[model samples]
Target: MKFSCVAAVALASAACGSGDGAHADPDLGVESSDTGALLAHADPEASGSCQLPDGPRTVHQMKGPLEDLQGDCVPTWTQEELNAGFTRIRDERMITLPENPGFERRIPWLAADNGCEERAQAASYYLTNWDYTTPYYARVLVKPNKRLILKTDNEPGGSVRWTHHVAPVVRVDGRLMILDPAVEPEKPLPIEEWLPRFSVAGEVDVALCRDHAIGDGCFAAAPVAPSPPQIGDKAAGLHLRLTAEWGVQEILGRDPHRVLGDCPPWVECEAEPTPDENRPPTIRHFRTDRLESEVFFPIYVIGDNFVEGVTTVRVTGNGVDEIALIDSSTMRSILLASWYDPGEYQVTAANGAHVSQPVVMKISEF
Candidate 1:
């Protein structure tokens, strides 16, 4: 589905920041080519076209001759578009994973006991038949009866691993189909022969398969845990909550690098300001400072009398480099920072620069 252009721009702005006065790293992981390495494996001779009944669609028919399936397919959205889309998907689905005891963590096919080959074949068939565009993440919905169906990238011989990679599938007529980018990378196998080698631990029935959704958009929503008051100290608490959301995205293999080609590797953090409320309340001693190290330059906050009851501090840009709480009177950094206690603390950059805003946490005593 299409997202609001304004919202997309806001999200992108939050992720990349203004880059004004921001130090750019020359040797960062950003690649010259915009296309992902994974997509480079598409077979030149595969005998299928992306022309589905809908508009200009790309379809990979599993069990087809490679030569017959060769065609050029371009992604509709740019890297920025995909990044914003991924962030939205993560925020929406962050709370779906099961948190209680005895919960299954791994994807159904990725389990140890299941046959890897059979699962691979089924994944291949599903991918060959579907259309996949970049800037999209796949959400695998496994049902109870062993039926495995997906909503993204229908190409013949394509396989889905727990890593969240889906390959191309080419079907030659009805007899033989091949999946590209196999684990071996050298050999493409027939679907029927490959299916038995993979195991089917769980099944998924598609409750919803909306087109162009960021992730699978198939599985039913899972329960979410309530946000905790304080997880740890200022830094730890923020990191914990962000990490939980990142972990869920990782489980689905929705890394920014994979979904959005050429995007920087970023650790997700909470965005504090809203469209209506753009800036935090100003205090007298509040200051904005930049911390620089051999690796990165990060923004931080510093202030006195900042702690208040259940105050929500919003942070944007890249992930935190390091955080330290300090005593205001002593002017010395405190080793222990606790969210439960009210105290004056200083937040400094790992590279030895004072943060602009010193976040204050105040909990009500009722």
Candidate 2:
């Protein structure tokens, strides 16, 4: 019943706890708070103190409410201590999230960033290094019998088939609040009701990773959550990725504008690099001594720089045959069949980049 929204942005400062008398209602005066707007629709299902024994630790334990949560999985550290990972919990919610001073801070959640690792790390570094100190949590829950990534246009994608989604949850009072700081603004909801938005298209593999930051005692070998080695998570990495890509402007400037960014609204500012064309191969000589055969025959092609791999020999003059590479290191020979129209065929080779000069191949009905 006590649903509140974050009005102001969370301060990137040290952890400041709320005392026993710190209990206060949501800042209803927030007219256009991004988080406040989303929290308005919050429908809490379950309430009361946590029943489970091991978790939902006190706010004092978690430092502050959960932040920096992601829906996808990206490896941050290998299985070692040097590269530490956050502890994660699946399909569960923490009961006691502290209302630290930084709780009210609102972080802008941006759209997709193409699996870039460096930008991801810089964000995490900023969050951890900054003054804002909140004990971020990782809650990884896999939605079973839900739609996962499906294949599209010869490329495998998970978002297309993603009917259900997973995220991290922080316990406030006695209820759990979902912190999906990647796509949507931070909105707190119960697990039962929260599970519906992601309609089960199929089964999905989801993980909630928390960032211990750096030198916080968490390592790759042993993470907080009982999950895989989380790389770039929403908890810290995502928050930062969004910031570096776009949010940083907001952190320093008043108007958080995206001239061109990864998410929607801002179109891609830069164009993708076009691949350079390969140099055409120089055909020194072509053995035009073979007649049409029923099966297949070899055409010896002597040339320079006939790509050892992925180089195909194409024949196109009177007729054409599907070029298949037999052995293309020193001597580039191709297997030619007799299915083409009987005439003078020009044989050429290509390595996906450059095309080789034409060689004469005379074929007759033998």
Candidate 3:
């Protein structure tokens, strides 16, 4: 079922790519033309609307092995990298358009009235865009009977409750840290520090869903089916879903709340955007044309917010191969020549000024 919110509780606090010259060949299983269907342009008409999908939800497994969340497939970062990411994503909060304060072109981080899922997703989007690895969602889910409550000044009653709460999580030096700017704007919090904000911390179960696991497969071994809401139950299951079926669309199509209905009477603050508003492109997911790693095939890089005409793709590690922009909307095509040696390499996208976190791609006939 859709998450529920209550106006109770006391003082708790808180909170692109390029392409190659590969064509749309279904037999090859690579479609450069399909990126348009995936692109979710900003909705100017429904700017401030914060409507989430209705009904029961399903939490699917991620694309990579579970070890990725533990830093096996994902890269770990230093504390300095963590600070840089915190600054970049937190600064993207939507603010100040005299006519419609929420009309600003950024995530509405400052307003915590509702839309935790959207805030988490948008924060993850910006994190991956800032040269960091794809961050997963660290969700706290409780049995149907109990509600997860938090004390915060942002809400009208100085508190808010939900069936579940989520935030972007990243791997830093072997630890998973929560990046919830709305709750803890000053810095990133380790999972240990994050759990205390909610009243029912001991009652909820936590789950991690990678940003790429849009559909089923990653958690097939132990899946959480959506259940009807009940009260006072103590089941270790969570009803969760990625919200959006594809990448980028999660942020754009969802139309996260730009302005909270119960926002405190604060003036329309001026948009204090950072000097570099143009974010670097991201590499959300990528795959080779063929299943066999030994064979030479074109690689497809799918992502969002790519800067057209300027974005470029490249692979490095065992070998170096550059790719041309195939479709600027949200995908890139890389034509790997047969002569290049085959081995595991990191694939990344760049928009001249910024480079995205790398996704692993192997081109060997193993």
Candidate with top lDDT is 3
- Give me the runs in candidate 1 sitting further than 4 Å from their true place: 1-137, 144-210, 214-360, 364-366
Could you give the C-alpha RMSD of every candidate to the true structure, in order shown? Answer: 20.6, 20.9, 23.6
Lowest lDDT 10-mer window, candidate 3? Answer: 236-245
lDDT tens digits by residue: candidate 1, 254-351: 33222222221233444322211222332222221111111111112232222232123332222332332332211111112323222233332221
Model 1: which ten-residue window has the lowest total lDDT?
3-12
Q: Per-prediction TM-score, please? A: 0.21, 0.25, 0.40
Off by over 4 Å in 2: 1-126, 135-147, 150-267, 272-366
Model 3, range 283-357, lDDT digits (tens) per residue?
A: 655444212223344444555545545667776777466664353232222232323466777777777768888
Give all candidates' CA lDDT scores: 0.24, 0.31, 0.44
Shift in Å, residue 111, candidate 3: 3.0
Please report the candidate that would top TM-score against the real structure.
Answer: 3
Instruction: Write down the worst ten-residue block by lDDT for model 2.
Output: 13-22
